[model samples]
Target: MAVSFLNRERTIATPGYSRWLIPPAALCVHLCIGQAYAFSVFNLPMTKLIGISRSAPGDWKLTELGWIFSLAIFFLGVSAAVFGRWVEEGGPRRAMFTAALCWAGGFLVSAVGVYLHNLWIIYLGYGVLGGVGLGIGYISPVSTLIRWFPDRPGMATGMAIMGFGGGAFIASPLSVWLMGRFATPNHVGVAETFIVMGLVYLCFMMVGAAIVRVPPPGWAPAGYSTPVQPKPLVTTQNVFVYDALKTPQFWLIWWILCLNVTAGIGVLGQASAMSQEMFRGRITAVAASGLVGLFSLFNMLGRFLWSSTSDHIGRKNTYFVFFALGTFLYALVPYSGAIGSIGLFVLCYAIIFSMYGGGFATVPAYLRDMFGTRYVGAIHGLLLTAWSMAGIFGPVLVNYIREYNVTHGVAAAQAYNVTMFVMAGLLVIGFICNVFVGSVHERFHMRAVEAEDEVEAAPVFGGR
Candidate 1:
């Protein structure tokens, strides 16, 4: 009976329950999982696990350690696509609870791997299991929020997704402090840190699971009325989740998200190193880290600001700004370094990172526009495969290109120039993808009879 509490029926919102409470519930899980962005803080300490102060002969290479984040992201997409429908049917509470377990368990298992000095165990723990948590937790609240605030779906989703970006702001410093507190002469303290963080995240995410609820069927905000005429590209008809994939609009949006994410993620992953290398002596390690935190701040704010803006300007036009402006900014980054202007460099990246976060926050509402809300969450999950692909593509392109250039005697300052142009070019391609995205055809819409049948057959919640 306790387990049944998480069921879809139980989660249906009671009459007069405030919809505003939903965003905070979603934030609880997102902020915890958003710690993924700060996992980089653990990299060097993990490498020194064997040597205490440096890498021992048998110690894991930085390159080997890099796979941990990549695998986690890759599996995040994979698991979301695989389990998305289940999340839709079973409801947010069950999905969030499951994610909490996997995420916390991952830290425990990874702590054991750290103690034993086993790379495979870390990968299995954090990469596979934790990644599943990320995927499920990431999507669990999206549709629920959209349904709750159908009048302002973009703002609703943004409020929740912004937590994902801001999670790093809290996590990066917390992880560092925990490691410092636990470090000893013979030990790096990573295992213990992981244990504590896992427990903390588990507690926070469980709070989210308990608080989340679904809007009852046919619920709408007071005084809200369906528009007399649907806006361009905004669909009222539902598309079955699988039928969504058959539309060209889906793949175009897919490429749009992929290319946008690829440009941003590459720079995000390498922000500290890139800043230090580009500015050389002008930017110290500490300064570069401060820059990273600033970027995270803009990243979080952008999710809320830009996505909320999409509500007025339209999602398509918002992405048009992202690609058009993003291309110019990416191209401008190297120029800032060449001119030795720290202000210019920081300003350019700050704006760029904001749009990067914006792109993520806006896409769910965009999906609702193209596919309708009935299966939007599941479709959004499948679309996240683009993120998984970009996760690999962006990092490899940036890292390898920089390595190749440096090996050939390119200065650290100039080495990223070519990569910057390449990123700009990718955004150009993304801009064109945006141009091709249009409304889904009527052929893909679920028939009116089918829709009525679905509502009739659906289980009554709260025994109504």
Candidate 2:
């Protein structure tokens, strides 16, 4: 087994390292440890503290928290792209080390800000510092895993990336429990929570980074040197980022990602608040909280379950489901109740939620297929800018449009209808794009890939 993954003759001379188990190890930390999204539970307590200190609800707003998240996302891409180049230059081990430092350090710094009652400091810590960590850590395993299991790109990357999304499910609950222990009405013990979470994640994420390593060159998976399925007209050869970006397929994917992220993030940011707004007259606070928890459960499951489904269905078809089913679901959200059922609304959102989650897990494999795996981490980094853009558009659209309706005499129930309709429109456009996606044409195939394969095929200077 070991011999299959190593250079027995030491001829080609790319270092031999373990690749098979590392991706899941990286994802274990990504999924189990990255509960940062659940950072919202800390928000109300922080808000209350700021409120007690004389900040207005609107001024010390939860929306401000959105900025922190948005900034983090903005930098996540920037960091990944900048650092991905580094990963290419050095290796996953080096990249993961950098990621670990920034991750923990960001938290430690943010804890100081919280203790000092300085929001700006907290922003700097979590947004700038932590986001850089996220970017590095996120892409660390992608190219490595793709290299190791060339046969199963979708399943490999999906398993780890899916964990990043699902990490919050467990973290959110644990965080809430932690906050409860540390919180006071005037001060939610956020400072301590930051310190503790930062410490814990630092340790966990670093372990992941520490464990990862690259595979030997020219080696394929045990049973998969020549793919059982026909290699797409595409291969990773001579492919470069600039060339891949030039293709129509790239832009189509970009738009699809932008739409997918925009719809889901808009809903995610406002899930708890939306629940409260919807049930203001009819449901209690406890019930609303329960609904939010249910939403979180579904959101986390969608990452694991939906992306795993893609392993069997293939990336193109998986996205076809996302864009098509998601559009229908978005359109249904507004009228589900008036059409006589809350159950429909719940079901609609749930499916939309899964599509949003699946869209993320599917992309790495899709990119590896169209472009070569050589620069996959970098290409993926570049692609995440779409998510950053959506991070801004999704929430702002929901907020601004909903506010306009309320100011112009729309009832609270009707406030989000316009927004829902807009989301539905966007999903339709994405569906069309997904429908058009196919394997890249041969003209676009990279030159380096061909040369590399040709070199490997030639008779060795001495064999057997």
Candidate 3:
């Protein structure tokens, strides 16, 4: 009730009754914005629209549409790194407000682009401008939420980032429904779709932003939490972020994440298409699209389930499971056709996709456990640039390697096998990085006695 623009570092109090409200508020925004993945639903329609508008309708290709979505993801990471510092300083509420504004505005901008038939404008609006909002909105509440629920950093982060994974779930159906309502064959319904979706997400994310606040200083979860089971810090309060940067731990985790994500994302970006290509008769294009949607279901569940499991087992153990288990499953995709069972293929793909989602949701807590939460948002933002990198490498590797195999006279079945092996090797390397995460030791971490935010942390959590 005391929420305002005042510097939030000062002491404030809320009844214990209010503590339970924060996590649900966090989930609301995530559930909506996570639809970024579902942008695929628009691919055919957008291409249809473009083909109709262009004099040479037959020349338009699906790859061109893929590029538009890929561009959006590439900028998502780029913008996150640029805005991370601001999000840290401004507090979650302020950061989410900016995200809502840019994201909604990007939709309106893209709507205009579509209405005017300017593909470049649409790209600029969604890819460059909206992507920045995606990045900022993604990381804004991470540090504050982790601090609030130290007992469940993995679960807390999973809950927040899970939005990114599940965004497509609600998006796919909604887009389909709206498409039916507004779509015409010669022209796409995208303008209206963008207008309606943008307005809806703007309202939804604003509600989330309004409800968002960091836990009061020195606060702890209602019951037991992460602090009680002691782990040594890697660096001291005296240590600077630059100093933490120098340690091998930082870069090691970086490569591990890069490899892990690349292996998974490569397959994920291609799954529906891959399914359609691999099993022509057993699954229709609609069935293949359903397979892709199934991936989201698994991806969303893994974020919550595996991350919560980390609360009990520790983060390293979770990554151990992901890399080791992921390595085996990823290696199976191309060769799994020996039996020729489509259901088997779907189940296998679902398992791997879940790990992909789990890896993302779990990594933040892994960082916090070793590094301390003082500058977690900035550090996590920097680390997520790995995703941007994955956004490039995953698709490129699969596309390039498969192209080579096709040119070499390798059959369609064998074309993807070698790439699958390469992905497995990458997972092996990630497994090693995680295994080598020696304790951070207190001397290596950045620390802070209090930000203005500290005025609130201790008093709120000090007692029951």
Each candidate structure's TM-score, on Cα atoms with residue i matched to residue i, is: 0.95, 0.86, 0.90
Q: Spell out the clash pairs found in candidate 1.
A: none
Q: List, residue by residue over 156-229, the lDDT tens digit for candidate 3.
A: 88887777787877888999999778876666688899999999999998888767666655567667544444
Which candidate wins on TM-score? Answer: 1
Write the residue-wise lDDT of candidate 1 on 355-443 in tens digits.
99999999999999999887788899999999999998998899998999999999988999999999999999999999999999999
lDDT of each: 0.91, 0.72, 0.75
C-alpha root-mean-square deviation, each candidate: 2.4, 5.7, 4.2
Residue-pair clashes per prediction, in order, are 0, 5, 27
Q: Model 2, range 117-166, lDDT digits (tens) per residue?
A: 77888789988998898888788778777777777777777778777877
Best by lDDT: 1
TM-score of 3: 0.90
Which pairs clash in model 2? 31-163, 236-372, 237-449, 238-448, 238-449
Model 2 steric clash total: 5
lDDT of 3: 0.75
lDDT-wise, the better of 1 and 2 is 1
Sorting all predicted structures by lDDT, with the top scorer first, yields 1, 3, 2
